[model samples]
Target: MKVALIDYGSGNLRSAAKAIQRAADENALTLDLKVTARVEDVVAADAIVLPGVGAFADCYRGLSSLDGMIAALNDQVITKAKPFLGICVGMQLMASVGREHGEHPGLGWIDGAVELLTPSDPALKIPHMGWNQLNLLQPQHPVLAGIAPGAHAYFVHSYHMVPRDRAVVLAEADYGGPVLAAIGRDNMVGTQFHPEKSQATGLRLLANFLRWRP
Candidate 1:
């Protein structure tokens, strides 16, 4: 499968692609990878991957500069059930609004909001870095196959997405509390953490994503 990694100045495409390549190798699957900043890549890709880091406002501005990415994705890929995945701030960009820019609008593909990760726990630390266990809410889906309820993965972010619909949240993790860590709605998949940086567990996660067919 040809996996188009959207490289539009907001994400770590090299690291993400490296991890995905490892996952493909592990699963004996061949993934033709491309870091694309072009319009045709989104349309011709077998699946789309949106990976990002940094502020929501900056990311949004960078993405908007691409022209018609949001529209093509929302109107064609997502609405038409084409496979798509998002990582870290990439997931946040899919939300309707983010507080990063003091009410910055997002891609509005998913009904959700992104807010700074405030420490409800006095001792827990911000950013939520390092390895943490994922609390799987529903493991029945193929996208989560072989992934246990308490699988560990690396996380490095200070913001989390609060999906407006409970049905869209596939998994969560205990940070300040139980924050949304993963979301999936039909063909659209999102992760608030960097699966690419999570090592073996991360590889498995990406492999599962590659194997997902719904």
Candidate 2:
């Protein structure tokens, strides 16, 4: 399988790549994994993985700056219905718009908006960092196959995706309130937590994603 780990000048590319490669190796799955900024690579890939870090506006800007990247992604992942996984801010980019720093347009793959984390408790931190338990909403989803409810995933972000349609949310984490941990519809899925940093649970999710046919 060909997996395009998109490089649009954001995300921990090396770590995400290493983790993905490790998952493929462990599963004995043959994969041509490419960490690429090239549009052609994304066009030819069997699956797409978008990993991003930093601010929403900046990440969107970086991705949009790449000539034909957005359109290619829309074609390959959206139109073609190829499997897609977006990490952290990459997941946030799936929303219709983002409100971090300023309002910016997103890929609109999912019906939602990216906004600052507003935990009900006044004492909780802005960047909800560290390990948090996942409350599986769609545990039957292929990408979440072996991942149990209450499984811990690593997170580090001040923003969260608020999907307009609640059914799109696959998993959630409680941080004074419900925070979106995962979202999906049809062939697309995204994780707000960094699966690469979640150790065993992370690897399992990645492997499930690799083996996922949907």
Top TM-score: which candidate number?
A: 2
Candidate 1, residues 130-191, lDDT tens digits: the string is 88889988788667788878888889888899888899988888887888888988888898
The residue pairs in collision within model 2 are none
For each candidate, what is the lDDT?
0.85, 0.95
Measured with C-alpha atoms, the lDDT of residue 118 in candidate 2 is 93
TM-score of 2: 0.99
Clash numbers, per candidate: 0, 0
For candidate 1, what is the lDDT?
0.85
Estimate the overall C-alpha local distance difference test score of candidate 2.
Answer: 0.95
Query: TM-score per candidate, in order?
Result: 0.95, 0.99
Encode model 2's per-residue lDDT on 1-214: one tens digit a residue: 9999999999999999999999999999998999999999998899999999999999999999999999999998888999999999999999999999888999998988998999999999989999999999999999999897899999999999999999999999999899999999999999999999999889999999999888
Which runs of model 2 end up more than 4 angstroms from their true locations?
Answer: none
